[model samples]
Target: MLPIQPSPRRKAIAAWFQDRLAWDSVREFIAHKTVPVHSGTIWYAFGGITLFLFVIQVVTGILLLVYYRPTPSEAYESVQFIVTRVAFGWLIRSIHIWSANLLILSAFVHMISVAFLHAYRKPRELVWLSGIVLLALALGFGFSGYLLPWNTISFFATKVGTDMATFIPWMGSTVGRYLRGGDAVGGATLTRFFGFHVAVLPALTSLFLLFHLGLVQKFGISTPPWVEKRSRGAGTRPPQMPFFPDFFLHELMVWYGALALLGILAAVFPWELGQKADAFASAPAGIRPEWYFLAPFYTLKLIPGHVAGMEGEVVGLLGFGLLAFWWAALPFWGARPDGTVRSKLVTGGAVAFLAYLSTFSLLGYLR
Candidate 1:
């Protein structure tokens, strides 16, 4: 057979794509990428780990969408059908829940590691800010998703979380109403949360992720303080491993291990559909928000009825808000590439925060 000749349209289309994509440059960039080698390098995996879990969430979430109905009247029934009737629907839902939790956990670890390493110093400030933004979005995903099934716990939890907004300084009630799409956590609230969990939060997160990853690739991973000092003294940069094959394989191993763990957790504690939510019924006693929010919720519960002439809830809300702002702004503290606050001070602050959270959470559980 004679050799086929390309049509003019095909030739033009291929040329257009070639001009737009720059596939060769992308391949070259990937091939040249390197991950720094150091004793603390393994901590880097948590960032990638969080990213992988998010991918799992997106995939499993889409599958569950096939069976998930957002309406309050049908939400619980739809979830029940997925668990009991749909093929492997139970597995998919379980994976989604488990991965969501793990994704949050991984993000937390990555943030703490970055803080300790002072990775947010100097040129990478925006990377740290973007990462923090992504972390908040991940929490948003959890908060919104928890209410999707319209179960008893989720119903109460959403109510309690939304109530916090009512304590804000000026726009409290307005923001709270906007969140619920009305005044209460009813069908409107459920629908609003469903839209946020699947569409709004994901869209925001995706945009932030691209910004975050672009900066990470631009600046490269931050080397640990000790390693950097030692390398500087020795007049050389730290050794690096190729990001393409060697480092990528190690990341895959970490991901596989994480997946195995998530599978075990899901299989052992498959998500409960819980009692169908009844908005008219009183919220059950001892009801609390998800584990991530437990620390904050408990702190608010422990605050006295009033603080400094302000309503206790409002005072607590402002306090928490300030604390969050301070933590998020840590990178802008004029810290050098290697140092921010004194090491002991940072360590002590972290310890105190952990102790406070633990004590409050335990008391919350006991109470």
Candidate 2:
């Protein structure tokens, strides 16, 4: 066999790249003052757990794509083929679904923990905002993916979801029409959503993840509420450790634990496809979104019917208006060290409302 070797110029370029990557400056930048001073709280693990599960979802989703189809006629059959014929395909699909659920759940817990601890203040505002974006995009992924199954429940759910978009005012109907690719959900809508679920959103998510982690390393992880003064005195140097081998090692362990938990869930309750889509069939009893969406679904249901001149949909438009206002105001609201009394009130009300909604959803499931 002929010798395999790079040209001298190529070898020189490779060495330069390696040397740049291994530079002490980059190491110092990433490690900064990060320390292994562990608090040993399981709650701290949630962020890493969420990141790990998102990676897993991406991998397993790619595997499933090998056999899955997005077209109306072929979608259900393709999924069935993956589940029943492909080697360990069921396991891959189950893992993808379970990991997605865990990712969202852990992100929620992490966000709440960060909020209560006031970790979103000042230097960490962007980090928190990036996390909020991630959460929103993750939910978008769920919504788009839900329609890909093309089953009866998914069909109606998509119909209801897109129809709600039409409530947005003058632009609402236009956007809804564009999203549905016409007056109704059909072939073009499926194609657009499938592309977004598998491609566009994931690409944006990766960019946001980079920005979030960069901000994290730039500003040290926020300490818990109970821990103050990081050391003996305000001016005294705090005990510290390296990020490469110590703090990140803990993240690895936490990631492993999250994977184990996801494994158990997938094994226990692998996702089942509902009946093949009947375009003319009546909507199923008790149609509900995935768990992460139940709170929003309940919110839409609970909103009073009159706002502005419109009745049935005006309330929804106003609710969405409020949501946009909140997102726009987050950076300013999070700038205050105290997180504002009004912010507290709003967050508290949200938490309470979600809890109540979740309880009801569980009850419905039980019944």
Tens digits of per-residue lDDT for model 1 on 97-205?
Answer: 9999999989988988887776777788899899989999999999999999888999998988899899888999999999999988899998899989988999999
What TM-score number comes out for model 2? 0.84
1-367 in candidate 2: lDDT tens per residue? 9999899999888789878787667757765656424353445568888888888988999898899888888988999898889988888988888888888888888877776565676667789889988888988888898888788878888888898888877788898987888898887788889999999999999999999988887787776433445554565554456666776787798888788888888888889988888777898887887876665566667667765566756676676668656653555664455543245654675576457657856654544
Number of the top TM-score candidate: 1
TM-score of 1: 0.91
Candidate 1 residues lying further than 4 Å off, grouped into runs, are 1-20, 334-342
Native-vs-model 2 lDDT? 0.77
Could you tell me the lDDT of residue 259 within candidate 1? 95
